[model samples]
Target chain A: MAVAESPPSDPEAPPKVRVGRTPGRLGNRVFQGISTASGIFILIILAAVAIFLLVRAWPALIAAPSAFEDVGFMLGRDLWSWVWPLLFGTAISSVIALVVAVPLSIGIGLFISHYAPRRLAQGLGYLIDLLAAIPSVIFGLWGIQWLQPLVSPLFTWLSTNGATAWLEENVGPTIFTGYQAPARNILTAGLVLAIMILPIITATVREVFLQTPRLHEEASLALGATRWEMIRQAVLPFGRSGVISATMLGLGRALGETMAVLMVLSPGYLINFYLLQPGQHQSIAANIASHFPEASGLGVDALIASGLILFIMTFGVNLIARWIISRRAEFSGAN
Target chain B: MSKRIDVNDLNVYYGDFLAVEGIDMVIEARSVTALIGPSGCGKSTFLRTLNRMHEVIPKAYVTGKAVMDGQDLYGPGVDPVEVRRQVGMVFQRPNPFPTMSIADNVLAGVRLNNRRISKSDAADLVERSLTGANLWNEVKDRLNLPGSSLSGGQQQRLCIARAIAVEPQVLLMDEPCSALDPISTLAIEELISELKNDYTIVIVTHNMQQAARVSDRTGFFNIAGTGKPGHLIEMDDTTTMFSTPSEKSTEDYISGRFG
Candidate 1:
């Protein structure tokens, strides 16, 4: 059988190849290149920003403020003196926010997805989404003006009686100020942060819950499950990983929140465990926002260092979230 | 443990649109009754009403009476949940809870009802139910694995196991083998024969041969025209219905004349 070969390479004659452009292929290649370049550009910008923050923080990290002479740890001596307190404050407040936000968010999500009437469900979902659109600064103002006053009495009572008295007796007086000061405190800031992150967690969880396959829901119902029982048996188990990821997303937001914490909490340099006492704590983001404008060489670098820490924290949270999701993917049937 | 079902002048509606009208039949205790019909004939809808599952659909409602052992399922103050507990159902698709283990899937119905079962009792019930469904030998070693890890046939069997674990008096199966292969379909048919010894079984199928092979009684449903409500054309002993149906439409449907 004679094989049809490409037209014998005519070197002299006009090429039979017809190398004229094909718009579809050329456009596809151009679009592919554009997309790849954009992706790499994002990575480059992220790396550049991270490197810039590190370089700016280095000088302050090595300066060793006068207060560092009293501290003995190697890294503590080299880093800014207030770094530990700020780190502690950041972690505690964010954790407090998570503890407060997760349950409330899951409850709201379940109510909207499973219990509410169709029209009311839609309206409630939209209203919750609208909460996410509210600016952080506005939340800060609300926390300071309205929420602080509303909850001040409770804070005062808690600090004076209940667990606070027991904690003071056991842990010592130096640790807590016992609510003698104003209501602007880490507890208030954490509460505001919880409110700020609630919408995000609720929306993500609601979407996940809604995606529970109708077939599984029917299966549960056919097994004689009540509405709440069906949710527990089918919907909750199906959405477990989604809820964890959503909580992590909220935690990430809470970790980076600046304006709300800065506005609501009365900042201090000393490390204190009394979260209900005002003028006892300072979160890294809030400290940076408060001190950055007036800060000098070392102080500015210190702020940048704290910013770098915050970035690492959020990154760590996202990574852990991804790990948890991937680990549960096997049984979740979400793969 | 099985109970006879009496359905009288039943009419099912989705909002104002009647889907199935004037369905009257009796499903004898401890027998497999097969509902055979063409697509869009409301056979599945009629089957769903047996366990009050039809009303779970938005705007769906049913009229008339379906009584089991002299108790009206739709009587005033009769709880749908209680009715469903006594009348278990299997669907066309195999939907074992994807997140639950094989053993857990079997126990789901009982546990979901908040019934307290001792560990030994639960283990015994799981083995018994799985064995009864003819799936124990295949899945006994992997009871801890996710239910979704099983094949299509195995999952359907697991669903049957789940239903029987609740010890329902009647089992409603809607095309339990349509999605399965020929071999799996045969397996399910054999299992249905065994299941009917303990539970009243009502199954809806499009496969006429399946009805001929497994059912003691057969029902043929048909629609008058497009957008018209479906109604039961004829129901009789399976052998008589397949060989000498009373209605021309039943004969035409069983003889493959037209849907």
Candidate 2:
């Protein structure tokens, strides 16, 4: 082997090598500062919104029944009495939407991620994402114009044939019973909300399902698990916390939805179990959106107070979702 | 309880492309058969074909025959699921079901099949399988912990325990210790040596020394070049293959010449 020649200047002295610093140091600092500012900006906006709502709603929050006498619907009702019904409506409608949507989304999500042909899966995924892009107001229009008339006969049949009467007789008339025609009821609003939120939940679920580690899936298959068994063993468990957070995302939308509930439901002011009956319930967002325009003085404050409640409900739900997700992480295989 | 495998003129394909061609070999029962090769030479693909796991990839298929005992694994009406039940596989990476506890992962093959086992039987199976895999002492107390909690080597052994919990006749390992540290590699190699007494084992490895240490018989697979189908170059007792390979290319490969 031939020896390489060395530089003549470094024969008797230590070599001097330039230690160059990383390039674009200022750009990196600016980028980090911008990202950190953007993150803090979200907190600032959230806090500002909360403060504004509380300031506007404070008067109505302390108002007596006489102060709300000018409020057309549910007149002379105190803040708690009036807000409780709206809160009940919000919770029930969102619950109903989730009950109907979660399983369907899981099925569709699994189909697109695992069962469908590759080409078809791509198309179905695109279609579901497109559904999410549709405006909520259009969903409201479709709910009232198309879905309401379509379900009227079925509602009429159930009411007339005593199909749901047994629920009243047995379980003391929980929200599951009391069918009515015209289909402009809380249940109809809920079904429409279910349809509206289905795409959001399904999209999240599909992405999570698609992200199931290929190695884990192959391991399950190598262990002799059938397609369904593999899904139960690998796919579902991997996506459990993901699905809960996805459902919560859907619930957040359903809880805060205004146009769909306002347009589909005949708003009422009492907490009741007659989900299939019109004029039986009203969610907070729909209540405010409907009355905010005509509301005057303290009535405007009351609507803002209701909006504050909706804000808190959404916040509470997200907190609960994070809690569940963190709890699941303790046992999750992903760690 | 273990089974020997007979492969006759097996050709593996991915879509229209032939990945491996003209493979003929017999794997004996109750022994470890190691397939050694360079990267992308189809040794791993051949390992997957043993359990019909190759078909899990879209458009991947195999032609010709792979038989275990008296049964044709690729015959019509032979469910791949059933084939997999009898011939379990471990990947190059450790992959225990993430959502499952150590005990549940050990029972996954059986429970995933929807077979019913009593609490006592399940406990017994977990203990026996873990003990067999040489992982019992480390994880016996944390059987309820998520399987991912184990170290890389222990996770690989947990995967081994999971594969054997179903009591498969054959266990195919594809570079089972490739991702592990030196100590973990030794642990898995020792486990493989002991496991061959009860189960027919086929392993694919890049490590020639590992093949020499743990395998009774060794087969060399090689590709002519890129886009060419990989073929089985030669097979012999591990001692003979490592010392004096019959094929020039096998000797060149073993002697650290160009792959």
How close is each model in CA RMSD to the real structure?
A: 5.3, 2.4
> What does candidate 1's lDDT look like per residue over A1-335, in tens digits?
99975557756667656797855998899999999999999999999989998899877666647634433322244464567778888988898899999999999999999988899999999999999999999999999889988988877777677566777678876333467545788888999999999999999999999999998999999888899999999999999998998998899889888999999998776676777767767888888887777777665777788888888878887898889878756589653
Model 1 bad stretches (over 4 Å)? A1-31, A63-81, A161-177
Where does the lowest 10-residue lDDT sum fall in candidate 1 chain A? A67-76
lDDT of each: 0.89, 0.91
Candidate 2 recovers a fraction of native contacts equal to 0.95
For candidate 1, what is the DockQ?
Answer: 0.62
Error of 2 at B150 (Å): 1.1
Candidate 2 clashes: the total is 1
Worst lDDT 10-window in candidate 2 chain A = A13-22
lDDT by residue for model 2 over B96-192, one digit each (tens)? Answer: 9889899999999988756899999999999999999999999988999999889999999999999999999999999999899999999999999
Clashing pairs in 2: A333-B98
Each model's TM-score for chain A is 0.85, 0.92
lDDT, candidate 1, residue B256? 90
Best by DockQ: 2
